[model samples]
Target: MSNLAARLRARRAHTRTRRAVSKAIDTATTTTMRDELITLAQTHGYQKSKPRV
Candidate 1:
């Protein structure tokens, strides 16, 4: 019983760590893509339009 509990705990910890790493990677990818888009737009002389209320 103790061994099973230990295994479960380790698996949970690994899952949590994997999720955190995946989230971080996703965020970094999004940021990089956004930066690239902004650069491309700037190169094309695209201006940001104001949002209409």
Candidate 2:
């Protein structure tokens, strides 16, 4: 039915948008979190900081 098809399309669109948004947020947050963890370790002498030339 046309109505069913329309509903399916809308649902798919919503799912795709949600997935894309979550993926974007995940990348940004994970990047900062990883950086923070590495810095924290270095500060506590658990990890050494690489010298920047």
Provide backbone clash counts, one per model.
0, 0
Instruction: Give the per-residue lDDT of model 2 (tens digit) for 1-53.
Output: 99999999998876676555444444655778757755655564445323469
Q: For candidate 2, what's the RMSD?
A: 14.7
The deviation in Å at residue 14 for candidate 2 is 0.2
- What TM-score does each of the candidates earn? 0.53, 0.52
Local lDDT at 17 for model 1: 60
**Which residue pairs come into collision in candidate 2?**
none
| RMSD after CA superposition, every candidate | 14.5, 14.7
CA lDDT of each prediction against the hidden true structure: 0.60, 0.60
Residue-level lDDT of model 1, residues 7-46, one tens digit each, is 9999887667655544444465577875665565456544
